[model samples]
Target: MAKDKKGTKKADSSASARMSNKDYLRELRRLHVEIVKLQEWVKNKGIKICIVFEGRDGAGKGGTIKALTERVSPRIFRVVALPAPTDREKSQMYVQRYLPHLPAAGEVVIFDRSWYNRAGVERVMGFCTQEQVVGFLKAIPLVERAIVESGVILLKYWLEVSPQEQTRRLEARIKDGRKIWKLTAMDLKSYSRWYDYSRARDDMFKATDTGHAPWLVADSNDKRRARLNIITDLLSRISYEEVPREKVKLPKRQAPGGYREPNYPLKRIAEKF
Candidate 1:
């Protein structure tokens, strides 16, 4: 596999055949167990974690996040996919709106898309001026340094999907009823400017990929492998030990104390399945 400028391995588009669904699920189940352990350790140790996911449209960010958090507690594994900024938010500092969403002790916050929006979409889609983009790129590394120094374990991921695979996924979204909502006008607009996004991504990586919090690139052409690979990488980055647990036996229930079932009529919905 060829390495990117940052010395991270780029996803090889032609390397392998698709992973079998059974094998994928088996591996995912194992990872889920480990993720549960990570969750428990984070909670017990009061470790705050912040994970950022960024990529072009149809890059499997949502799916990967789902796989990562499916078996975890929602209270601890919080997913933040913020809507477009409101007028008041637009008036505030770009990163200010995001800081409030950072993880607290005992919480793991995952950003489906993050503050790097300015360096990616906002820059490529004409949403922000070149000057603003430059200023953001210049200042974000220092901001991230402060965030790290404040003890938040930050992980930023860039899911690199090949153009062919991205096209296939987007087309599938167009035809799949469940995924139709994933395709939007913005996605359509962004789809036409692939190289624009590529350039913007390059610049963003150069600016924000620091030693304190480096950007990890995952080849996402195969969604299953990408999800597993990212999850494995995430677990490796954190120094979490499995928290010991006490074995439990269910307490015996008391006999019903002369309580009888009520005769009142009750409403019931049909079990269609």
Candidate 2:
């Protein structure tokens, strides 16, 4: 590994140059193959996995998740991105809404944004009281401990982005039509209250960063590198091997004896392409 101008060790020499699309795709494909192997091992061994991804907006969590699951079976690897709690949910225990979505046997549940909302957005935006946030932080370790003790493999990731890069990403979202949906009024508010969010994050880490389920922080200034690094680290952490399988050959097609094309006219859409 070589050092970048920032003095951080680059994952590879390619970081010195504009990492070409070709290299990105090639590396992604290699990782996708390993992900497939992990998926198979999980299903075959009835391994339960729960992966939590949390970060500031535009920290590349969604893109990293897409790269992880694009080549894997959705049945085995499930993504849970819960929306704001409903009225009933608000009345329930803070963690109650998230409890039902945890991984079952032979399943991998990935939370795009998870229970840490109380520690981050909710507390910063006044959705949760200071006392409630404190209580949740204190109780979260017990909840996570139970999950891990119940034979579940839990991994929590917090993607860290520099304020400058965060600003550039949010500004790009404002200009790019395709990404406009990602920019919300709340985001603008959060952008202005960066230090407030920082304080909240520090508090959350102090309380909930436990040995049972420790938080893994990833630097996400470079989206491509961040995705690859996260995926590589995830694969390395999990203990899995390629499950053996028997080869299959395609059977010969059945011969058509009396089947004939229907005479009835049917409407078909024009193919402009």
Give lDDT per model, in order: 0.95, 0.92
Model 2 lDDT tens row, 156-243 = 9999998988999999999999999999999999999989989988998899889989999999988888898999999998999999
- 1-273 per-residue lDDT for model 1 (tens digits): 888889999876565577878999999999999999999999999999999999989999999999999999999999999999999999999899999999999999999999999999999999999999999999999999999999999999999999998999999999999999999999999999999999999999888889999999999998999999999999999999999999989999999999899988998899999
How high is each candidate's TM-score?
0.93, 0.91
Cα lDDT of candidate 2 equals 0.92
**Candidate number achieving the greatest TM-score relative to the actual structure:** 1
lDDT of 1 at 193: 99
Regions of model 1 farther than 4 Å from truth? 1-16
Q: How many times do residue backbones clash in model 2? A: 0
lDDT for residue 180 in candidate 1, whole number 0-100? 98
Give the per-residue Cα lDDT of candidate 1 at 181.
99
